[model samples]
Target: MSLLLETLTTGDRITFICTGLLGLGVLALLSRPKVVAAEDGVTVTNLTTTRRLDWAQIVRVNLRSGDAWVHLDLSDGTSLPAMGIQPGIARDRAIADARALRALVEAHGTGHSAT
Candidate 1:
């Protein structure tokens, strides 16, 4: 409002603008996550990073009932969080996506499920 703008100092207005921009950037980043399945591998784009993984590298795909999103178990003995398959509001879609990704990992890589 005009009153609020009039009361704020120039530095305060600049700081407020920067903070709003940063918040928008964070929200954009949160919505930027996705999973891409290619011929050779899968690409997981999380909040702050993107990882390209070979089919063989992914040992398992886990999306349990209580889980908020899919987690990929890699052959390197590490688990990577895949936010692309989150089951928050779209639970069924997320489940299907997890299953499809799992099938791709199995058919293209080692048909091995977590033991």
Candidate 2:
């Protein structure tokens, strides 16, 4: 760390420090997407934004064979992409997560719930 700092000018050093801080600030946000289910609702943390949805608001959880991630069919007639249940590196886990979320939606949702 000292060797890297020693080679840079004062302005460059400041810039480097600022960049490092900025990079680390959003590191976790970029590294992992999450879907958390609680008694009240589900919280989905995507790449840059997070959304909270009540169980009744989610009509279905769709994760087709060729899909990259699960998608929620909402009561408001919009689809929300859930990147947390992606089938890229962990296909079995993703499928299991998708099934679990789907089961929750089916059990709790009342408005147009389906398989």
Error (Å) of candidate 1 at residue 99 is: 0.6
The alpha-carbon root-mean-square deviation between model 2 and the true structure, to one decimal in Å, is: 2.7
Regions more than 4 Å wrong, model 1? 1-3
Number of clashes recorded per candidate: 0, 0
Q: Pick the lDDT winner.
A: 1
Query: Where does candidate 1 have its weakest 10-residue lDDT segment?
Result: 106-115
Write down the RMSD of all candidates, one decimal each.
1.9, 2.7
Candidate with best TM-score: 1
**Residue 22 lDDT in candidate 2:** 94
lDDT of each: 0.90, 0.84
TM-scores across all candidates?
Answer: 0.90, 0.78
Error of 1 at 23 (Å): 0.9
